[model samples]
Target: MMRNVAILGASGYTGAELVRLIAGHRGLRIAALSADRKAGMRMGEVFPHLRHLDLPPLVRIDEIDMGAIDLVFCALPHATSQAVIASLPRDMKIVDLSADFRLRDAAEYRRWYGQPHAAPELQAEAVYGLTEFYRDEIRAARLVAGTGCNAATGQYALRPLIAAGLIDLDEIVMDLKCGVSGAGRSLKENLLHAELSEGWHPYAVGGIHRHLGEFDQEFSALAGRPVEVQFTPHLVPGNRGILATCYVRGAAGDIHAALAGAYADEPFVLTLPMGEVPSTRHVRGSNYCHLGVVEDRRAGRAIVVAALDNLTKGSSGQALQNANLMLSLEETEGLTMAPLFP
Candidate 1:
């Protein structure tokens, strides 16, 4: 029996990605698609690349019949998803690709998003959807919140090291570079082709970026105390992928061993041979994360770098992985694509 899935905000980048992946999935069908402003338009009209797939016409969320949909993928904007999902049938499993339910604390949500959470009850119910770390939780969760792309990259680099106690948690720094699509399909003056084409610059400096809420929550929880790392994100001129360079106080060999041991059995995570770092181009358009460890000249310092596609592994693809778990299907059923290399 094929499961019927609905994609809210179907016109956005992540939503289109969901469509792309689902079109190839053998057990899932695109039953409904919603785009508030693009209602009544065919998905092909908005995303020409998806024209080949036969899909439902885009409609507003209110027009969707929840009875026919088994799963809902909410790719709506941050604040919008909460209100919309709140009104849906309580039993429908949701994989939200928005920031609304990612943070556990409502206060933290307000602090970063500048508004009280409209659905605190649902916020409390949402499981953080870092597929590798929260696999069991996601498998049983009714609502799963997809991680921030940059946060995902940094965590993949540091989580294993922190969990194994191989690094000095106090002296950690994460420097990340992301492609433009991570900003979403929204039109902004800074993301315009002319301005973003040939230049690169850092935004959200000084721990001001909202995704830190996730880093603070997940890392601190793992360390059993407060853990704060200097995180800086820069926008590169490319269209997809994220490469994060993490500096930690630890021996290079230990960092390599910890990562290798942690991800040895995991399918999507690849810890490269020591001293061989990953590049964004290698993991582009795939649900794979590659990590490399190298020793710094300073005896107690090491460099850990990770690469992944910001859109795939970091967002929509992650959402689909969580959805597969919640539905009791094989986790890697539809995510077998190899990275597209130049």
Candidate 2:
């Protein structure tokens, strides 16, 4: 009873990560892979690390026979997935790793992305794929929009406090640092080794980052009112991982207790002891997310930090987690592997 799945845009970092994770999965099989430009080439050619696995050759989206596929993981770029997904079979289950369907409001999509949504109907149906918070909706959803990496990291640190009214909603601030892989495999002058190595600076300053749209949408829905957090992301030199440091107005002990209580049963989210901090290196190359809370020097202030692999728990690994629930498989299956460490 192995469910056959396909990875669209198989040439990117997230797509390769999916192949790696699925290679260990017992309930799923890689039936096809699509890479418009890399079609007819082997996945190994595009990603040497994945060369060991016996995987299908890359093909164009039109070449894949959807009738044999049970699920599709869309890792295509933001504006591209809308058209590609609309062309797929209506009944196919999809876990999109792109930002296309993450926002519920089409108007918000246009405002953030600067274009009208190409598939409004699909946008309306996509369940926000923050696996832990939207489990039931994701389980029943035919299409699930994976949360943004930065958004996911910040939420893991603050969602419980927001939900429990333990923190001041108006004073939330998140400063995140992520590796370059989150930028994808696309060639960019700024990403060149000479430019990126030995240097790191913040971009999308002043809450202009696209992931903020996701934060506004999700946090607002949780608070039952408009909730806008000051969020800024920086591109660090590492190859993988995201570390989000969120500052909020609340008691540090209560923040720790709330997070520990919230994720006490979650297999992948580990809430550390009070005052300890999480680092991206510890959670690298795994689906796990480590969270910690610390008291600020000033009273009534707290610092919460969360760390996770951007390519895993932030994207592909999360996609797999949601797909597991969608496919009725064990939620932790293929995702419980220990985080890679030195």
| TM-score per model over all chains | 0.99, 0.99
Would you list the C-alpha lDDT of every candidate in the order shown?
A: 0.94, 0.95
Cand. 1 TM to true fold: 0.99
Superposition-based RMSD of candidate 2 using all C-alpha atoms, in angstroms: 0.7
* lDDT at 335, model 1: 87
In terms of lDDT, the poorest run of 10 residues in model 1 is: 327-336
Tens digit per residue, CA lDDT, model 1, 148-239: 99999999999998888989988999999999999999989999989999888899999999999999999999999999999999999999
List the lowest-lDDT window of 10 residues for candidate 2: 199-208
Across residues 6-39, which tens digit of lDDT does each residue of candidate 2 receive?
9999999999999999999999999999998889
lDDT of 1 at 273: 99
On a 0 to 1 TM-score scale, where does candidate 2 land against the true structure? 0.99
Q: What is the lDDT of residue 333 in candidate 2?
A: 93
